[model samples]
Target: MRLHFLGANKQVTGSRYRLEAAGLNILIDCGMFQERPFLKRNWNDPPFPPESIDFLLLTHAHLDHVGLVPRLVSQGFNKPIITVEPSVDLAEIVMLDAARIQEEDAQYKAKRHQKEGRRPKHTASPLYTVNDAKKALPLFRGVKFREPVQLNDQVTVTFREAGHILGSAFLEIAVKQNNATRRIVFSGDLGQWSTPLINDPTPLDTADCVVMESTYGDRSHKDAGTIEEQLANIITDTTQRGGNVVIPTFAVERAQELIYYMGKLIESQRIPTLPVYLDSPMAINVTELFHRYCRYLNEESRCNFEQRQTPDLKFPSLRLARTAKESIAINNIKGTNIILSSSGMCTGGRIKHHLRRDITNPNATILFVGYQAQGTLGRQIVNGDPEVRIHGRHWPVKAKIAQIFGMSAHGDRDDLLHWLTAAKQPPKQLFLTHGEEDAATALAATIKEKLGLKVTVPDYEQTIDLT
Candidate 1:
């Protein structure tokens, strides 16, 4: 068997891996490079021919894991794209939104370049169109959690709950050859334990080789209860000061989680009821999915919805902004209303417009409830840059910037270690990916010192033999 690390080797986004086993060529995650320095990779041709891939295994519907599949399909890939059921629904929404954004961006850039009378260095065209994304949708094959799906006579794959998001999972594959079976696991963005809405990450006792994510390998998140407390304090303080709380949210898990917490706070009388607007159509659609997949949610959230008839994410003060006019109307609201918009990293979306307005308002609180990758606008704000360019104009940074670290969907250092140590037997080799260099390196050292296991942090396009 052989494994290839095509992307997300020493970076946080763009996660692609190729595995060859039992005469089958399988691809895992065909993600987009989101950081500014690596955005060029999104336009590059696949290192291997797209048609050569036989199957695409998706762990979740996060853009970083499923964003580039449409482009891959447009390049001649026609294969089965397998993932959990909820991810199937979520991926369709994410890809279509991504294609629309790309097409709009391309048109905007072309017009700007023409007006300036300057030829652009790069092609002012979309990487893929909405039609391309649509063609890729028919290939998806949704499977239930923990169900084993046979790839061929010699290999079988299983999906297990990752507890990261609605339908996130870690993959387990078994390959039989020469009267022996070899096991491999791919840890796809593990989540924290005892978090609301979702169950804890499922643990596996054994594997021969493993590839894991190290997104937060260097630190620990604050306790979950503390996250709500900090969120309440920030919103309450901002409201008392007659300012809004503008949050850059991820459409999938982060947005729903924030809404749930805000609902709880209001119900408990911990924070005064204020207008809470979900300002992105995509996030609004995703919130509705929470109701459809209530069974996938944790017992408390599920019971609260089914038995109490009170959705944890709904309250009298909450509003869904689904149209451009509705989104614009939010800016005119008098005071202290909370707005949640996407994309979470502020790479693109209505969040930028919100930020452009509130980042300069002294009483406003710009809250971040998700991870911020480097070279993105969100990172620039979080890093305390005095002035930032948005829509080609510089804006002063006067707002109170706050982040709730415990709200991250990705597990932290201690969580990762606990997941590993719980395994009945350590894998012969462990490969870490999906993190910046410092985080991966820190995790490697800690694993070596504590577990005495052989670990490797592969580079982009690196290939290794699995013995």
Candidate 2:
């Protein structure tokens, strides 16, 4: 068997992998490159023929993990896209939103380039159209967790809960060759332990080889218990100053977690009753999905909903701004309020609009509750860039910048170590991916030193043979 590290090898954004075994080609993920340095990769042709792959396996609905499906389909990938059932619903919402955004961005860029009397190196069309996204949707095949599905005579696969977001999963694949069976485990973005909305990552007993994520391999998160207190303080300080608390959130897990915490804070009277606006239509749709799949949530969140006789995500002061006009109206409100919007990394979305409007207000607070990839607008703002370009104009950074590390959905160094300890026996080899160079290297060293396991941090497009 051979493994190809296509993307997310020594970086935090794009994530793709290919496995060639038992005369079959399986692609793990086909994600978009979001970091500025790799953005051109999105327009490049697939390194391998799309038609040559037999099947596609999606780990979750995050854009960095599943954003390029439409583009792949447009390039002739015609096989079934398999994932957990809830991920199908979420992926549809995510992909359609991505398509709309790409279309809008393409049009805007074209007009601006024309005004500047120059043309872009590439065609000014969207990466893929809405119709392409629709074409990819029907090919999705959702399965129940832990059910073994035979892919062919030599391969059987099972999905286990990853606990990162709704319907996120890690894949356990067994491949048979020459009367021997070898097991491979893929850790698909493991979540933090005891997270509020999602269950803990499922523990695995054994595998011949393991491919894991190391997004936070270099540091530990703050005490999770203090997250609520930190959020309360930020909100209180910003509201007291009569300024909005603008947050750039991921439409999936991060946005929901924020709402869950805010609801708890309000119920306990730990924070004042300030109007809170959910300003992205895509995030609003995801919030509704949370209701539909409430049973999948953690025990505490499920119990909270049961006791309240209402969704835990809803609170008296919360408002869903689903229309553009409603979003615009949020700026007209006189008093202090809280606004949560997405794309989490501020690569695009309504969050940029919110940032542009409030970034110059020293009283305002721009809160980031998730990881910001290098070269992203969120990273620039968080790194204290004096000025940032938004909507074709430079904006000064006068707002207070804040972050709550404990609230991140991804697991930290200790959490990753704890997850590894669940293995009954250390695998023959462990490969770390989906992190920056420093993070992956740090994790590889730790696993080798502390666990006495053979570890490697693969480079982009590097291939490894497993025998």
Candidate 3:
């Protein structure tokens, strides 16, 4: 078998990998590069022909993992994109949103260049159109967890729960070659063990070789308090100061998780019952999907609805801002309220508009609940940049910036180790990817010292022969 480290090598975004086994070309993911340094990679031609790939296996619907699907489809890749059932719906939403953003961004840039009376360095056009995303949508094949999908007579693949998000999964591929069976495991993005909303990640008893994500592998989330506690304190303090609490949210799992927590907090009266606006249309749709896919949720979240008949996402003060007019009107509200907008990394979407309004207001609070990739606006703000350029203008940062480390979906160092150790027998080789050099290297050292396993941190575009 030949393994190709296509992307997400020594970096946190753009997760794509290729495997040549059983006489098939399988692509693990087709993610976009969000960090500033790697943005050009999204436009680069695929190292391998897109049409050559027989199948695409997605881990989840997060933008970093699935954003480039439309581009791949536009580049002549038309094949079965397999994932969990929930991801089938979620990924479509994410891709459509990304395509829309790409179009909008292109128009914005073109107009700016025209206004400046300067020609753009390159043609101001979208990387991929909405039609491209639509084309990709038809190729998705959603499967149930643990259902073996046979690619050919020699290869079978199964998706198992990864606990990272709704429908997130790690992959188990079994190959029969030369009268022997070998199993290869890919840990997509392992989640915390006992987190809310999602079930724990499934443990593996054995594997012949393993590929895993090393995001947050260098450190632990030893924050001062739990997510709920920190959230309550931030909201209470911000509300008391007569300021809106603006949360830059991810539309997928993070947005829904915040709503779940906020609903519980309001019920207990831990924080004042202020108006909560879900401003992003995409996030609203994803939250609604959570209701439809209740079976995929953790036991506690499922029981909350089944036993008590309680609305997990609905409350009297919770408002849905689905239209552009409604989203604009949210900024007109006079008093304190909670606004959750999408593009968690502040890379795009309505969160930029929300930040434009609140970022200059000292009373307002900008709270982040997810990891901000380096070079993203969210990272700049979290890093305490005094001034930031947003929407082509510089704005002084006066908002009280805060973050809840414990709220991240990716598991930390200890959690990754625990998950790896779950294997009854150590694999012959392990490859770590999807993290910055420092983080991946740190985890590599620990794994070598503790597990005494042969581990390699492959470089971008590197390939290795496993057999």
Candidate 4:
């Protein structure tokens, strides 16, 4: 078997991995690159010819992990793609959102090039369109958690509960090649243990080779109890000062979690009883999907799910704003109300407007509850940048910014070790992906010291053959 590391090998963005075995080709996580310079270089760096690939297996629907779906379809990849239901629903929004951003960016780049008086050989265009996104949707083949489905005579894929999001899974692929069977495990962004709204990540019995994410490989999440108190305190302080609070959340799980937390905090009287608004259309859609998948909830959240099964699932002060006009209207009538929005990293959406409005006022607070990549507006805020440019204008940062790390979706180093040690025998080679250099390095060292396994981090475009 030949394993190829195309994207998200050394750095954490575009994640494309190809495995060639037994006269079959499988592509995993055909994602788009994010961040400034990397996004520019990777989105257009001529993708591998789509025809050569036989199938695409998606690992959840975060934009950085599934953003290139429409592009792959547009580029001639007509193949069966497999994903869970929530990931399928969420990927549709992710692809369309990415297309809109790319088109908008392309327009700006073209105008600048024209002004420079150099007719470049190429003009920028969107990576894909809304229509392409729609075209890619029908090809998704849904698989249930912990069920083994045979792809062909020689290969069977089983998905385990990954605890990351609603439908996230840890995929184990068993392949029969050269008259022998080999099993490979892909820990697709292992989630933090005991997160609300989903089941926890179940470890595999064993595997011949393992590919895992190292997103938080160097750090541990804060205690959920302590972080909950911190969140309550932040909101109380802001509302006491008569200012609104803005949260930039991922349109999927993060938004739902924030909503749940708001409900708990509001009901517990830990914070003011102000109205809470969900301002992202995509998030609204995903939340509806969550309502549909109540059976998948964890033990604690399932109780809340049963409560929401009542007709009036909404609490007294929760508002789901799904219209652009409704979102814009927030600026008009605002007190100490809390607005949760997307994209989580503050890269786009109504969150930008919320930030530009509330950031200049010292009374408001911005609560960050997830990992912020380098070069994102969320990271800048978390890192205390005095001023930031948004929508071509500079805004002074006066809002109180606080981060609650316990709510992160990804697991910490301890969780990773726990997951790895559960295997009967250590993996033949542990390859870390989807992390920064430092985090990956620390994780690799820890794996060596604790588990005493031979591990290596693959560089971009590197390939390793398992013979």
Candidate 5:
């Protein structure tokens, strides 16, 4: 078998992997590149011919894992896309929202360039359109978790809960070649154990080879127990100063998790009851889906919902801003309130508007609860940039910046080690991807020292033979 590391090798975005074995080709992911330095890859043609692949095995719905499906379809990848059931619904929402953002951004940049009498290095066309996303939707085929499905006569795959987000999963794949069967496991964005809404990652006892993520390989999470306390303090401090608290959030698991904690704080009166505005329309929609798929949530979350006698996500001050006008009106609200918006890395979205309005106010606070990829606005702010450009203008960064470290959905170093140690026997080979160079290197050393296993950190577009 030959494996190709097409992306997410020494960086944190654009995750794609191709496998060729038994005269068949399969692509594991076709994500868009989100980091500023690599964003051009989203517009570039696929390194491999899209039509040459026989199938796609999607692990989850995060944009970095599945964002480029529409572009793949536009480029002639006409094969079945397989994933867990909930991911199908969530991915559709994510794709459509991405397409809309692309179109809007393209138009905005074009007008800005025309006004400035200068042009971008490349044509300012959207990577893919909404129609392209529509075309890609029909190819999705959902399967239940833990059920083995035959992909062809030579290969079978089973999905297991990853605990990263709703319907996120890792894959257990078996390939039969030369009358010998080889087992390969792909750990797709494994989630932290004891997270509120999702189940813990499924443990794998064996494999011939393993491909895993190392998003947080260099460090362990901060104490999870202190997340609520930190949040309460920040909110209390910001509100007491008569300023807004703006949080740039991921539309999926992170946004809901924030609401869950904020609800608890309000109920306990640990923080004053202030209006909480969920400003991203996509997040609002995803929150509703969270309700529809409550069965997939963990037992603790279920019990909390039962005890609340209402939806677990609902709080008295919560407001869902579904329309553009409603979103705009949030800026005019009087006194101190909490505004949660998306494009978590501050790449794009309503969060930018909230940041523009509040970032320069010394009385306000900016709270980050997720990873910020390099070259992103969030990273710049977190790194203490005094000023940042947003919406074609620069703004001062005077707001107090804070991060709740334990709220990340991705598991940290110790969690990754725990997951790996669950294997009854070490695999013949282990390859780590989906992290920056420093992070992947740090993890490789730890695995070799602690587990005494051979580990390879593949480079982008590099190919290796799986013996």
Candidate 6:
């Protein structure tokens, strides 16, 4: 058996892994590269031939994990991609959204190319179109949790609750090769425990080989209880002087999580019932999905699920901004509104407009609810950048920009350690992926020192033989 580390090895963006065992070829995740330079590389041609792989098993619908499917299919990969039901549903939104951005970005780059009197550095073709994304949709085979299905003669796969987002999972694979039976685990973006809507990550009894993620390996999250308090304090301080709150959140989990917390803050009388505009139409779609799949929610989250539909379940101030005109309306809106927008990392989206408008106000607050990848605007703001460029214009950062650490969907260092403690026995070797160099290296050291286990952080596109 051979395991190939294709992408997202030491870096946080693209996530693709290949496995060859018992004459079966499979990929764990076929994600896309993101952020500057990394995202720019997406047009360089296929990293590896997508047609050669047998199947893709996605953990969730995050673009970084499932964004490349359309491109893969467009390049003649005619294989069924399998995931849980919610992931399949959410992928519809995520990939289509990503496709639109890719289209716009390519057009922008091509126009600049024309100005330079040169053919575009990149082909004007997008990674895939919305139609392409939809074409790939029917290929999805949604499996229920813990149900093991044979992918081919070589392997059987099971999904474990990752607790990160709705329908997120860690895959467990059992392989039969060369008259030997082996079981391995892929920790697909482990989620923190006690998160609002999802159950805790399922514990593993043991594995022979393990692939883990270390997104927050160097740090521990703040106490979860303080999230609301910090949020309330930021809101009160910012809005007391009549400033708006701009939250750059992921349209999927992070956006909904903010809504949950904001709902709490409002219901608990922690903050005044200011208008909370969900500026992304895609995010509004995801909220309806949550309502459709209410069974996936935690006990508390489900309690809010209407057994009987009540018009009051929808908040009057909870405005859904679907069209471009509505999004632009937010720019001129005034007085103590909390507008949660997307591209959580502030890379691109309507949030950039909000940031440009609100960041110049001394009393406005820019709140971050998730991990911002390096080279993104949200990270720069968190790092105290005094000025930032938005849609080709410079915006001064006079707003009170702040972040709450505990709101991350990914499990922190402590949570990873706690998850490992239940392993009963450590694997022969652990490979850490899905993190920046510093975080992955730090996690590798901690896993060895604290857990007395062997671990290595693999480089991108490196391959290892499991003979």
Checking candidate 4 for backbone clashes, the offending pairs are: none
**Candidate 6's residue-wise lDDT over 367-430, tens digit each?**
8888888887788899999888876568888988778889888999989888877887878868
- Clashing pairs in model 3, backbone N/Cα/C closer than 3 A: none
Provide the global lDDT of candidate 3 against the true structure.
Answer: 0.91
TM per model? 0.98, 0.97, 0.98, 0.93, 0.97, 0.95
For residues 144-210, could you state the per-residue lDDT of candidate 5 as single tens digits? 9989999889999899998899999988889998888898888989889988888999887678899
Model 5: residue 54 alpha-carbon error in angstroms: 1.1
lDDT of each: 0.91, 0.90, 0.91, 0.81, 0.90, 0.84
List where candidate 2 sits over 4 angstroms from the true fold. Answer: 121-123, 223-225, 304-309
Stretches > 4 Å off in candidate 1: 121-123, 223-225
Model 2: number of backbone collisions: 0
Instruction: Mark the regions of model 5 whose C-alpha exceeds 4 Å error after superposition.
Output: 120-123, 303-309
- Give residue 210's error in model 6 in angstroms: 0.6
Kindly provide the TM-score of model 1 when superposed on the true structure, using C-alpha atoms: 0.98
Question: Over the stretch 1-467, how does candidate 2's per-residue lDDT look in tens digits?
Answer: 89999999899767999999899999997888999899988888888999999989998999988999999999999999999988999999999999988888888878988888987746478988888999999999999889988889999889998889999999999998889888998898999888888899998767999999999999899555588899999999988898999999999988888998898899899989889899999998998888888777888877876677787788889999998899999998987899999899999878888998999999999999999999899999999999999987899999999988888778899888888889998889789999999999999899889988889899988999985
User: Which scores better on TM-score, 3 or 6?
Assistant: 3
lDDT per residue, candidate 4, 1-467, as tens digits? 88988877657778878888777899888887776557665557444678888888887888877888887888788899988766777787778776766676567667766777867434366667678888988888887877788888999888888889888877788998778879888888888787767888897677999998898888877555565687888888887888888899998798888877777788888877888999988888888778777767787666766875652235689888888799998888758989898888887777888999999998989888888887788888899999998865789999888778888889898888888889998788789988888999899998898778888889988889974
Q: Against the correct fold, how does model 3 do in TM-score?
A: 0.98
Model 6 error, position 384 (Å): 1.4
lDDT of 3 by residue, 196-253 (tens): 8889999876799999999998989865488889999999999888999999999888
